[model samples]
Target: MKQNRNFIVGITAILIIMMLASGCVNKPSEQTEPTQITVSAASTLTESFEEIVEQFKIENPEIDVQLNLASSGALRMQIEAGAPIDVFASASQQHMNLLDEKEMIVKDSRTDFAQNSMVLIVPITSELEITSVDSLLNDSVKRFVISDPEISPAGTYSKQSLVESGLWNELEGKAVLAETVKQVLVYVERGEVDAGFVFMTDAKIAKKDTIKIISTIPTSTDISYPITVLESSEHKKESQMFVDFVTGQKGRSILESHGFTA
Candidate 1:
């Protein structure tokens, strides 16, 4: 009976040890879940960031990235409203300045990553000889589309370019405002508008043979891009890493591939 008891106790202890080992192996841990960072970027960054995120994941297996694409102005409003955004990328200094002034972005974290030129695009089928900005004033040109200046940097830049060129007042009446630059591209690509203004990067990704670039609009201010970590971010380390990745050589190569100047 003593020998049997010893064997039974031995087996019990072995089983208990195995169970503990299994628990340790299969137990969930904080490290099991990848860290997630949310990036609120301008609509023009859609393709480039999407590509960068894919490569970013390969290099950063421990981190997951989420993208929120929209006008810089609209994104700033979301951050102002306490949205859990980890990073902010704007197409203009105006929006970033607003957030920086309000103490909403990380100090000294703002970095200019890319520059873009505004281009005028039209449906591929339209044979209109649009050689200049002044051509839009032709009576035959019925309507043009631009983003809402109140919310989109593209729209603001478009308006600025037109105003500086002495055309905003003449074009405003015929202008159909879009909610985003992508929307403006869509409208022109689908022939819903006579002409549309979008970043040169946008024109590169348009539906094949759907749109044609007319001219690059001249703005009084250089169209610069800036990115920064938001003050409300819970993942400051990850956000800073992302900003570094985007401004680094790898990121510049990707941006350049999308027609943006580094």
Candidate 2:
């Protein structure tokens, strides 16, 4: 009888141990840490790139994308200074070319993913009779704003358009230089400046009731946006994947929806 009791107790202990072992084996795995990739992109791409990152995360839940948005020239300088950037997307080919010349970009990684146009914008409530780029020369116009050509692609394009129109010298003295495109938009939106030159995409994102597009400037150079994975990237494969995603159909669709020419 004692033997039977002992056997039964032994069986119960074995069952409990097996149950504990099974629980441990069936426990959910520790959540995986997502691999992070830093992407330094032009400020003009803020909205579109944000959407693309969201969509990319749905498919690549294991990868984390961090965006560093700034003027393309400024971003390029950052990369040149070795800012741990995995990818770079420039609003103009000029900045990308600078990196390429320095061999900072990965071989064959540079791709033109989008295009944009420069536009003059003004506050909707403005009394100015400006309707075209030529109208900016009117005596009623006191001050105009543009991104600083030295550090902003939009500014460079704006200046290029003015120069092409034979108005750079005439308008240069009247121009209020902004550090970034968004600042140019702000100056226009607040009626702080008579008019401001910014990317069409930036204008589209502004409050319609506060700002109005005056005219599309004719640029001398193509306003193409190029993206590339940096040669200094530790996450080259992942960065390339991001570049592919931006240049792919899905990325193009998102960019187009945000008023960028894809």
Candidate 3:
């Protein structure tokens, strides 16, 4: 009887171990659906954001990221039109404010990620001897390229800077308004404009050797880049994760490397 009882006890122990092993084997180790996150950022962020996005993918291989770069206003319009975007990074607070007013952004996810200074750039080897805002009036500086003030945050800031300096009204007709800041860089690179206004960050990535920074605008205007997760995001958790990464050390390093102030 004792031997039989012992045999039954040993058999029960083996069954229990087998059941536990089966449970472990059957349990899901990770989430099955890979989250997809889409981000709409200003064109100015194209280079740096692209680099950091690669790093983000390496860190979270299960998440897929898609980046859409354009003027902040244009992107906002798309988001308003119900385009599927998980995140937004605007060149200025005003654009963020517009989205927040419309409740397009996830509350408490917005952060002022970085700042940029306006810059006056000209073709690197241009013969024009322009030095200051006043010098832009020179006949040699025929075309002044700038982003369209109505749709680009950088353009609006540039316009405000000029108007505040009492130069906008004077330089209006000579100004060539491009659709985006990146377009302004294109005009400057191809010598389409004798001089152009663009963000310092843009001048760094888009036209470092092609153009020379004449001057960095005064910082009194406080141009900041704000990033946020969208309320309509299908992957809110992953969206916030990317936002945290950008505002954190890895993101800051990328921004700083590209001449942006983090």
Instruction: Give the C-alpha miss distance for residue 144 in model 2, angstroms.
Output: 0.6
Comparing 2 and 3 by lDDT, which wins? 2
Instruction: Tell me the tens digit of each residue's lDDT in model 2 across 29-122.
Output: 7988999999999999999999999999999998899999999999999999989999999998988888899999996988899999988888
Candidate 3 lDDT for residue 72: 96
Q: How many times do residue backbones clash in model 3? A: 0
Model 2 residue 62 CA deviation in Å: 0.8
Estimate, for each residue in 95-163, the C-alpha lDDT of model 3 and write its tens digit: 889989998899799999998889999988799898987889887777898899888988898888889
TM-score of 2: 0.89
Which candidate number maximizes TM-score?
Answer: 1
For candidate 2, the 10 contiguous residues with the lowest summed lDDT are 20-29
**lDDT scores of the candidates, listed in order:** 0.92, 0.92, 0.89
RMSD of 3: 5.4
TM-score quality measure for candidate 1: 0.91
Alpha-carbon lDDT of model 2: 0.92
What shift in Å separates residue 187 of candidate 1 from its native position after superposition?
A: 0.8
Pairs of colliding residues, candidate 1: none
Candidate 2: where are CA atoms >4 Å away? 1-28
